[model samples]
Target: MELLNDMALFVEVVKAKGFRGASEATGVPNSTLSRRISALEKAIGLRLLHRTTRKVELTEAGQIYFERCKRIVDEARLAHEQLGEMLAQPSGVLRVSLPVDFAVIYMAPLIAEFAERYPGIGFDFDLTPRHVDLVSEPYDIAIRMGEPESSHLIARPLASLVPRLYAAPRYLERSGEPKEPADLEQHECLNILKANTWTLHKASASIQVSTSSRFTINSVGLIRRLATLGMGIMLVPEAIVMDDLAAGRLLRVLDHWHGKPTPVYALTETRLLPAKTQRFIEFLKERLG
Candidate 1:
């Protein structure tokens, strides 16, 4: 037998007082258990038990060895229980990263619902505009916009946030409604400063148009703010403008032209996911739909 197994058996036999009792406790046969204990004594060069009677008594060495072996057995039992508990419920902190704009508008409801469902799991969220490193960073999950390039990390599509041209209702009254994508040239356009180009999709064919706007902003929230103020028409995700639309603050312009869906991704370290991550992703996907 392995040394650890022998040590464990020795401890059990000493505690139970004899091979017969230890065999019954550990389910090891009496003869094999006796031989194993003898082999352990020979290896250790110590008399562990004084036997050949109704019961057995521990030697000095047996008492010392039993103390150490009990600790090892206790540790093994604890490790087994910990693994089983991990399989049953989500535990520990689940750190996540997301864009500030997306988190505020779309993810807020999803997170509230998620927290209610998995009350045992804790969350740590970092909301920022810049991209975060998944491999080096401490976060377990990331919500990213636009198409993800090929990488080892797993990316699950939560939603395709299709953009539509929009402006404030008050702005439309001042600047007049845009009839087509080209009509945007006449209105003040709030541009998100990525590259200069914007793609406008029609019923049949899509057009890649280069735009020049007076208000060029890096922050999506700032751009939305500019549109809400009636400065210009902007192409933004419906999630961001849904409240404004419902409140009669923002109005959709050029209903015929829609921007292509900017894919939203729930990225993680691996596709073979744990229960907590899998459940959160599924929840977000369902909520988005």
Candidate 2:
């Protein structure tokens, strides 16, 4: 049991890169983590890490050992979590990475409801647009707007958001309404990232329109705001602009054509997840399906 604890500590220290970082992550003193790693090295009869002032590098032996130890630690953790699931209430810190605008505008109410249902579960949310590494990061789940790039991670579909073209009344008054997809080429489009082209579907037909933009921003909220301010027309998910449309701030264009649906996924490092994480994903699917 003592050896297993030491091995887990060693793994945490290696994952964190340095004793100070490990201390901050695990809430253990740096001196204690250092001593435990030293003890682990002595017991294994090998130098596990090359320590310098700036960073700690794993020795060849340490790299090999970490590969084996990580699996054991993960299995042990999974075992404990599986047992914990048998209880009436699941309990743990549920760390999640979420897209900032989406979470605030769409998921906040659902999250609040989930919290009320599972009071035993605590949350730590990172609402950033940056992609988080599921294997290396401490996050239990990540709610992403599109398909995950990494094949190693497991992803479950939560919802598909139908997108459409929208513009403020003021902008349409100035630029005139687009009668066809080709008309978009003549208008100033507010683009998100590199999505300068939009595919619109009507009945059995689809048209791809190429557009140019003077303003290209990464944030969906900002793009919606810019559209409301009559900066230009925007192609965005209908749910994102629902409030603006209700308040007469923006109007949907091309009633006969709608943009392609954007999928939202809940990503995890492994398919075998804790009860807390599994429940959260299930809850999202239930609500969003």
Candidate 3:
């Protein structure tokens, strides 16, 4: 419909932050885009944008309208793309957010294989520690290590990583190896932020140890590196330290007991995803599961 077209244009303008940017993105002349938006305002009998010579800002009503219009436009676009997918391989920009360490250590090979299989799909990957807003951001999916906090986003389980405790051979020689979980209190522990405690499980027995670390970090890569440098013992996913373990850079302690398995998820804003996103999630589940 004409109204739906105008709503899609409005959403683009809001996302681009101005008519000129939207014009560049949509390949429409700035004058025509401006005129259509003005006509839309008149039809709705409400101002949507506050425009100046330099920039355009959304009014309160415009913000609400943009949110609703974005979803509708997205659904329409997805429907159109799904029809195309039935005839050929799904093709589109597949934007994903991933944790840096996990992507490099565990997923890089799998992603490369997937890319090879789907040459039509382009990738825009964001490797950062920050939790991205699935609603506000343009990411198609986010591969996260733990469970997502928001209930609004749809989560698909990809894998469960078994975590284990490890220390550099030199560090174990110097500080002595911990025979049990409680013995960790006497050794230097390297921990991720907000993870000062570790719960190790063995059959029916579980031990909770409050770990102390001189250097608390946010990066799993950094923690692994520090553990290799003999700074302290680390509890991390076994997949992350496979190379180190094989090379004798790190030695596993408490081999009979292991930390809780951390679940990995692919998060999306809505369940009704485009074919590109849906296929990508399915591919990950098939390969990683």
Clashing pairs in 3: none
Give the distance in Å from residue 197's predicted Cα in candidate 1 to where it truly belongs: 3.6
lDDT of each: 0.84, 0.90, 0.90
lDDT of 2 by residue, 133-189 (tens): 888989999999875675888989999988889999999999999998899999989
Give candidates' CA RMSD values in order.
7.0, 16.6, 16.5
Candidate 1 lDDT, tens digit per residue, 114-139? 99999988999999867778889988
Question: Candidate 3: worst 10 consecutive residues by lDDT?
Answer: 82-91
Q: Report the C-alpha displacement of residue 54, candidate 3, in angstroms.
A: 76
TM-scores of the models, in the order given: 0.70, 0.68, 0.68
TM-score of 2: 0.68
